[model samples]
Target: MLWTIIGIIFVLWLLGFLFDIAGNLVHVLLVIALIVFIFQMMAGRRKG
Candidate 1:
């Protein structure tokens, strides 16, 4: 679930990086993905 979303974001980031499209919004996606990753890690730590 989370992996899928992260993968999508990563692909978009790569595309934006290569093509220089999306007008800086792609970096926003990267930030969101990082935050999501951090939150998930924290949640997993709490659960375990």
Candidate 2:
């Protein structure tokens, strides 16, 4: 589920780059997704 969200965001980010559409929003979302991914990894490490 997390991976799917990240993949969608990545695709949107790429499209934004190529078409110059909603680039800022897509970049922000990408950053947010990355932060979430990192956080999840850190939390998982703490549990294990």
Candidate 3:
């Protein structure tokens, strides 16, 4: 779920970087995704 969204955002960020589109909004997405990822990691959930 969250991982999927992160992967998609990453791909979009790469494409935007390669094609030079969206100017800066795509970078904002990258920053947002990084923050979410860090938060999720710090939350510390167990699957056992």
| Best-performing candidate as measured by TM-score | 2
lDDT tens digits by residue: candidate 2, 24-45: 9999999999999999999999
Tens digits of per-residue lDDT for model 3 on 1-48?
A: 889989998898999999998989989998999999988887766432
lDDT of each: 0.93, 0.97, 0.88
lDDT: which is higher, 1 or 2?
2
Q: TM-score of the candidate numbered 3?
A: 0.84
Q: Candidate 3: lDDT over CA atoms? A: 0.88
* Per-residue lDDT of candidate 1, residues 1-48 (tens digit): 999999998999999999998978999988989999999999999999
Which scores higher on lDDT, 1 or 3? Answer: 1
Clash statistics: count for each candidate: 0, 0, 0
Q: After superposing candidate 1 on the true structure, give the runs of residues whose Cα lies further than 4 Å from its correct spot.
A: none
Report each candidate's C-alpha RMSD, comma-separated, in the order given: 0.7, 0.6, 2.1
Q: Model 3 off-target regions past 4 Å?
A: 45-48
